[model samples]
Target: MSGSEIVGDIAEGALLARAVEPAAGEAPDGHTQETACLNCGTTLCGSHCHSCGQAAHVHKTLAAFFHDLLHGVFHFEGKIWRTLPLLVWRPGLLTREYIDGRRASYVSPIALFLFVVFLTFALFNLAVGPIHVEPSAVIAAKSGGVQAEADAARELATTEARLARARRGAADRRSGKRTGVRS
Candidate 1:
């Protein structure tokens, strides 16, 4: 083909491609998709809404859900890196800085607290399994000999009586009849 005709064809192809491609912040369809804050109706430009602090985009996929969870739990990004030093060595300075509104560089106090608590509990659970105990052994250790046996018998009798009373009260309530019990 001649140079002029080739150029014309390329321009036409470019126009067609541009027409088919969606614009930024738009869905596949021709309509302009809302990247606005679902909570407050403000236009969103980043990961979170500027006006309401809500996430701009919510992921519907399971992989994205897990990615978010992992990111939240483990990813310190730049905030933790900036906050940790001051928090560990000069907490007063950190607090002062945060209170003075120089907060963009550091993690928020509540977020740091929650993350530390979560980390502590997660580590503790990993290090130590659920506690197990034998009820008879525990009771025997607390009490000794005939006294222990007598205490156990008394406790069993009391428990049985309480259970019987509870059952009677439930029955009365179900039957829509008033019993001697106040409730």
Candidate 2:
């Protein structure tokens, strides 16, 4: 760090302010200390490395990490908006278009299934927290009926069975329906 070298660095920083070419890894967004690609030795010309597709400035902060986690999950380059309606209303058309090599505009079927599965389990866990099995007598009393606890127990068993089947995975539900169709 001589004074002359400090002036040179200041001049380069000033170049960014002007209409001239900015330094490597210095985009309009943020300045990166990286001059060359971390993954490949190629000089970065943009926010993403031109040679390899890795981002020039990888965020190492905790906030950045969480932001990436959320963005990666939720933001599929705004393709979800194009994907969901077709998937729901015109599934055959969606599948045909995807298989016909027009996939970049929509989320792939496998990716949609995976995201739905993750969301389903996350929401199911949140909704079903801890299971509390109360005694049958309480249920009959709550109903204000004079029926025996045995009748209450049977009703509870039937309701529990329905809930158990409802909680099964999508594949399991489909298979169960197929089995029913076959029989």
List, residue by residue over 1-183, the lDDT tens digit for candidate 2: 999999999897767655454353355555445677765667878777787565667554456657655655676777899888988899899888755434446765656666889999889889987666678867867676655667889999999998876655445666664433222
- TM-score of decoy 1: 0.36
Q: CA lDDT of 121 in candidate 2? A: 89
Q: Top model by lDDT, which number?
A: 1
> Which model scores highest in TM-score?
1
- List pairs with backbone clashes in candidate 2: none
lDDT by residue for model 1 (1-183), tens: 999999999899868866876353255542334478655667879767787575656553456656655665565567898899999999999998766535456676766777989889889888997668899888887777778789899999999999998998998899999987776
Question: Cα lDDT for residue 9, model 1?
Answer: 100
C-alpha RMSD between model 1 and the true structure: 17.7
For model 1, how many clashes?
Answer: 0
